[model samples]
Target: MTLLDGQVWTSDIYVDGWRPGRGEPWQVREPATGNIIGRVGTATTEDVAEAAAKAAKAQHAWQNTPYDERAAVLRRAGDLWNVHSGEVQEWLIREAGSIGPKAGLETHIAAQECFEAAALPSHPMGDVLPSTEPRWSMARRRPVGVVSVIAPFNFPLILSIRSVAPALALGNAVLLKPDPRTAVCGGVTLMRVFEEAGLPPGLLQMLPGGADIGQALVTTPEVRVVSFTGSTAAGQAVGELAGKHLKRAHLELGGNNALIVLPGADLERATSAGAFGSFMHQGQICMTTGRHLVHESMHDAYVEALASTASHLPVGDPHRGEVALGPIIDEKQVARIHRIVKSTVEAGARLAAGGTFEGPFYRPTVLAQMEPSMPAYTEEVFGPVAPVVPFSSHEEAIGLARRSEYGLSLGILGDVGTAMEIADSVPSGIVHINEQTVADEANVPFGGVGASGTGSRFGGPTANIEAFTETQWLTARPQIAPYPF
Candidate 1:
């Protein structure tokens, strides 16, 4: 059957198989043209309970299945991703408002995530431990029955599958809840991929809904873990609720990342990196460069060059034309971005580039002479807005970077020795020398700290093992020793 079979995308949710959701139907729209692409089902709290129950029941057998069998399923899923890359990229462009390159990147990464997870099943799952008593002792890892993945609209495919694939590969069932706006690409697409790959029924459920559905997933007793990727405020709530329920929560939250341009850096190359980091996917990425810190001696030239680069980049309907950027996810996001720009501009920051928008297409913007207190400087503007600040010394740059509550990603463009030294002082989870903030690899551990996330990094063998499994200590003896009275 084709990837976009009638039952998959048309259905509201996936429980035992594709089915209608109990809640009202949701109309999925293209942000650029404001056109309804399709109407799909929305899940309710009742649906979440039912899906969680099914997942819990399925986990026992899935875990007991041979390790090679589990690994084979993930391998097939990865191959399917590659086989249908074109169709998935189309969905990403139309549903997620991704430009051509961004859409291609998402499809590529989705496949890689599956491929990486395929190796997880065969990895060593435990270690031998020395015991005081004359007994064989070991510590082993086991799946956390059911995982609830709440994925955001931005980079939905990558974020959702990064957790979903690994959890399934490690022998756990998954309940995926994608943001309603981009549910088709994020939720339904995944359901189809694994289904075609021959995943067992009731092992994976896709429930597309809003906050209420998310809450239900967190509180469901069958769900032992919640993998959340979204705003910091929402992540905080998820983390808190999961804690109250005594569940493990893997949160990859928001970031107000910084890109520092030190002395002796190439102006052209620095501006190019800055523009890409701030405007890629309209800067909706969690690791987007929100702040640009340049040495005072080169601040003015850097600002001019960066604004020139931003102004030249194209922004329009990705499906209609070749463009560097696409529309904001919705009008609400557009309004939020404009408000940040207006407030920051009024607070003495100069609008160096674009500060206007039409429809959902906000121009790539650059704000100069920014301070710590400005909204654009402090808030995580999930839009294509870049704020530039100047620092006189490396100490001042480090201080400015550390001023925020976020410690997600940091980028430094300068001498290797100086950049490495500066990186050592920053408390971010990921740091890049002579590179932009937006970077990811399937085999690398990806996450953030402080307000950005819970520090339970995702991806890589070690982090995924820790994120999806629980530790159990076991000991055995030929005979039981008598207890001393």
Candidate 2:
């Protein structure tokens, strides 16, 4: 079925099938103009519980299905992503406030995620174990039955599908709860792809709602695992609730990542890398470079260069024009970003460039002479704001990078030897040498340390297997041995 049909309101939420949500219908608006682009149905907590139950029941047959069949479905889904790229990109641009390139990247990575997951079914499920007794022993990986994937608004398609694709490939049903703002690109689009690719009914359920639905998904007994990607505060709550309910929570949370520029680095190349890392996607990414630690010798030049680049980047409605950056997710997010920038300036940081905004279109901002204790330096400013701080020694840079509670991604621009040495001292889930902080691969283990996540990691074969399946020890004997009564 055609998913977007003239933008008329329809039942968008998927339970057993594409049906109307029991809750109110949400008007999907464009962040650039606040115009109603489309309407999608919203889910209630009761709907979440029912969807979870149905998903759990469907998972039994799915897990027992032939591996080839499962792999075929995943491969087809991957193909479908490319086939529907235009339609998907439209929704992403309108619904998620994504620039053209960012939207395209999401679609590309989504397809790659599916392709990677397609191979998961054929991978070795378990290992042979030695037994002391006279019996054959084995450790087998079994599906967790039902997985609940809670995705954030920023880069919704990639974040949601990375976990959803693998869980389904490994024989687990998934109940996806995307942020209400980007439900179309994040949830409805995915449901349409899997359905068209021959995914059976009840195998993947999309429930777009608010916190009530998310809480229900976590507490529901049918959901065996919770894969969450959002703020650290929200992740901590989900983790705590999942632990209380005896379910595994694979969290990919927030980050105040660092980009260190050493004295030996090429000033132009370093500034370019830092600008891309901080201002990409309006800096809504979890791995965006929040801190710029520059050597005192090159600090002034780096800040000047970065600010010049930021000032030239065009910010506007992506759908209307080809712009370097689009609007923030919503007015609230825009306000939050401005507050952080204003507070940082008040606290003594210098706003080198872009201290102002126009509606939701926050200008790409750069702050210089920043202290580690300032809000802009410490908090995860999920906006196009780069706070540049100077450090005299490599030791000081490493110490500043390690100061944040988050350990998601780190970037170092310098000689190979010096960058690698500094990388060794810093703790981060991802480290980029002479590259930007924001990066991802479909096959790489993606997650973070400390408050960034639970460190369960997502992506790659080993991590996917561990995240979606439970290990069971099995033993067999030629004959049943009787125990003494």
Candidate 3:
């Protein structure tokens, strides 16, 4: 009898207003105790195909509907998100063992995305081209076809609905496949919110299952666009499938972000800023500052200071209402982090601070004297472990930071001159000066490059809506145009 139980969250699959028996149910686990969160209905290959077919069949009416109609449903969906915020908050905490400020972020970010998307105009894509004043020049953004939203486990709510909602706003039907591990907490309830918003049957459906369901959705001809957020390996697979089928795919993948702290930088400011990126979600975010490149002179002092600060970060149950760090997502993740840490130690890395775990909880750990060859430094640990690698020169620090195959995110805390210089040169999508790499406000474009991800997200209303919609250049030929001049 381990910590977790066998029960799971259960939900009826909604297909054309009929609750059908989709074979095989999922056992959603509580990450902390590894107990049953609930058994959500799992979608089979056939179930997925049927759902896609239904969406394709309904696409005509769905896409033709007015933007106001679509916006109303989206706004209503936000209301529903609040209605279920309590339950969702619980799921996020249980699934990710998300603690303190991080746990609440899921609820607020999801609600913000929904509420803001709901307010977007149906036809904001206007027409203009001042360069050619005497000629007809206009641009417009139109709805793409059906989309399959495959989201990752970390920040499940933040990533999943953020992508799907905008697409829905643009009059596109969607089939969202959330990570099976987080189906109950983030996945199923998200769909319930859409349902509560009175979404037209078949306009949006959730298929919560394993890779089989994902493959089914991607390969299905009816799924015209595929938007995914997950590991780089899985992202490559999805991209390949989309390419093979000649379909549009948007991928938000993994990262091994780096944060550089120069000699003259404020140690407290750098440490505090970097802490949120790696500690929040237990460092599961792809854009988190997973690597710390400290100036050689400050290496020892910074490590000692960071270790002391990290040790004091509270650890406990997410529901306890304390500023504590919760466990990683699940048991396997717990073991994976263990192996990475062990391997890093074997490769000559030193554990500077907390590195112990009971159940799924791994106390926030700090590692130093790690080479790029070490797993913890090179690979995406996806845990609260920051590998502090020191660099002698400014050039070397920037070089080490940009040397990765990943260019997802980077940050610099130093003199304004060097920080800005590094921010400009860092080969990442988002760069922060005097701040942590992963601190993305909702209104800015957020994503990565290389193996990191293909798109971005922001905090503002427009930034929020771009994820789900595609740009379509619409033109208007004059009703009565004169002959060529």
Off by over 4 Å in 3: 1-11, 17-21, 126-139, 320-323, 457-485
What is candidate 1's lDDT per residue for 177-217, written digit by digit as tens?
99889888888889999999999999999999889999999
RMSD of each: 0.9, 1.2, 4.2
| Candidate 3 lDDT for residue 47 | 87
- lDDT tens digits, residues 41-102, model 2? 99998899889889988999999999989999999999999999989999899888899999
Each candidate structure's TM-score, on Cα atoms with residue i matched to residue i, is 0.99, 0.98, 0.90
Q: Please, what are the lDDT tens digits per residue for candidate 3 over residues 39-126? A: 6677788888888888877877977787788788888887766766666676677765676466567777777667766666544665
What value does the lDDT take at residue 199 in candidate 3? 83
Using TM-score as the yardstick, the better of models 1 and 3 is 1
**Candidates' lDDT values, in order?**
0.93, 0.92, 0.77
lDDT for predicted candidate 1 compared with the true structure? 0.93
Task: Point out where model 2 deviates above 4 Å.
Answer: 1-3, 6-9
